[model samples]
Target: MNEQQENKPLISLQNVTKTYGEKTVVDDLSLDISEGEFVTILGESGCGKSTLLKIINGLITPESGSVSVNGQKIATPAPAESKLVKLRRDIGYAVQGSVLFPHLDVAQNIGFVLTLDKKSKPEIAEAVERARKIAGVEKELLTRLPGQLSGGQAQRVGIARSIAARPKLLLMDEPFGAVDEITRRSLQDELSRIVKQEALTCLFVTHDTAEALKLGSKVLILKTGKIEQYDTPEKITQQPATPYVNTLVNR
Candidate 1:
């Protein structure tokens, strides 16, 4: 384990549960994530992977239990906009696909968060450059609009934007799911490098077992809104906690 693992958890969920129209999406989930740790969440469809991420980000409030991030308790049942915005200032959320604004150019899109945070032009420029460099984005693409770029390029820009503000926690939902195999591999490598370099704690949600095994310091497997197993990739592969986990590893 890295030194960061020895530190206190930056995110904590205690008996968290989320229900939508009588359907429980996340049921009594408790998790702790250490600072700088990369945790990948894996599950089949309707297993509540995305709901878990949203709960942590305070985007979706749980019906029961509590959540805290960086030692601050997030209001459950309903989070105030001001509090959510303040909490999210330290979090970067990258949805499944490339979600860049079509009207904004690459540089504009990457610097959008900083702009929202009321950063000066010079600071935004410096941050944008550093983020783009870390994300492996070429300088030539900075001025291009999102519609002009390929899926892979748009995804990279989205990642760059997520990191541009130097958020402590990053939430990525299938960031590489829309691209070709080659492009996905490249993005995966880039994400690993950036995460390590920045020492950013990440919660990545994906359906790809291989991806979950490759990039996560700890892999969390969910089955029907419940935790099937949560452990290191090596441990999960060698000694799965349940039959579902065993089948997932072998499959």
Candidate 2:
């Protein structure tokens, strides 16, 4: 990548807005996320953290404005399904509860996207092995079904699946939320290592302040669909931009 391209934001949102009935979920939000940044979106429920992720991923169409991922505009008015599919394939997504296909074995689950894309068996196998190693999934567990795995194992499998496609951006919505505290910490440490090793640009949503602070190179504090503060973790802790930010960082 050229220096200019490397310096440019990998993801950009311009005046994006989303509404459900009479309620506005994301209200005229604008932001730019640079390449290789791990941005943690921290907010209370109903603050549009998940909505923002969906919008970027082209899963949720906004009421107005534009979004660009890797310089390609998305979520346009009535986008083609094929285009959305292509876009989503380039962006990895993992959510809470480790939603895996119960019928698929661990290897199949991680290779699911590759299967859909009709990748060769050898290619799929290679991708699955690389992803599992990165996500900390054991080789022996590859033959086990999702039902046979523990919660932590299932979650790791979910992560492996998301990254198997080698996406440029990763969107994670509280991926560790359902696990026990000890498991959560282990997952966090593993994820931190994985992100660095992969040099991924990630947008991770979490309600936990400490998790946000620890995982994010930049922390985005949201309030009712608006940005309260978008700054480095150190700056946020030292110089909170608003009273709400202060309360969040303090409490």
Candidate 3:
């Protein structure tokens, strides 16, 4: 990519809003995320962090405004399913819990997307190996099912599967929430390394204030469906924009 292309935002949201009955989950939210940025969305429960992620990956359609990923318009008043599928293929998504397929063993689970794309056996094997190494998944576990894996191992496999396709964007929603502190920290370090090495843009959602600050290059804090603060982690700590943010920082 040229300088101009690299300078352009890889993800853009404009006047985005999503409502369910009387509740407005995301209200007129507008944000631009540059390529290769690791943005962490930090918020209280029901504060629209996950909702915003869903909108970006085209899992949830906003009631108003627009969303563009990789310069392709994904959300309008109505989005085409075909376009959404194509867009999602380039975006890796992993959420809380071990969301692996029980029927598929580790290798099969990690190679699922590549298999869907009709990749050859050799190509899928190579991608799966790369992903496993990046995510710290053990090669010995390839034949084991999800039910046989520990929480940390399962989470690692989930991450490996997400990156197996060499996605341009990775969306993780509280991916380390269930793991032990040691495991979570290890996973965080591994993820940071992978993001830097792959030059991948990542949007990671977390309710943990410390985790958010530790992981994100840019921290975006939300309150009741609106932005509370968006800035560098250093700036957020040094100069919190709101009392809520200040409390979070202190806490």
**Winner on lDDT (1 vs 2):** 2
lDDT of 2 by residue, 139-211 (tens): 9999999999998889899888988988777889888889999999998998889889988888899999999
TM-score of each: 0.94, 0.95, 0.95
Tens-digit lDDT track for model 3 on 141-194?
999999999988998899889888888888888988888999889889988998
Q: Higher-lDDT candidate among 2 and 3? A: 2
Candidate 1, which ten residues in sequence have the lowest lDDT sum?
89-98
Where in model 3 is the C-alpha error above 4 Å?
A: 1-3, 90-97
Q: In what order do the candidates fall by lDDT, top score first?
A: 2, 3, 1
**Candidate 1, residues 1-251: lDDT per residue as tens digits?**
67665777889999998889989989999999988899999999889999998888788888899999888888465768886886677554434335888999999999998898899999999999999998878999999999999988898899999888888888988778889999998889989998899988999999999999999999999998999999999999999999899999976
Candidate 1 wrongly placed segments (more than 4 Å): 1-5, 90-97
- Candidate 3 positional error at 118, Å: 1.1
Output the worst ten-in-a-row residue range by lDDT, candidate 3: 89-98
The number of clashing residue pairs in each candidate reads 0, 0, 0
Scored by lDDT, model 3 comes in at 0.88
Q: What would the TM-score be for candidate 1 when compared with the true structure?
A: 0.94
Compared with the true structure, the alpha-carbon lDDT of candidate 1 equals 0.88
- Local accuracy by lDDT, each model: 0.88, 0.89, 0.88
Mind sharing the TM-score for model 2?
A: 0.95
* Candidate 1 C-alpha error for residue 207, in Å: 0.4
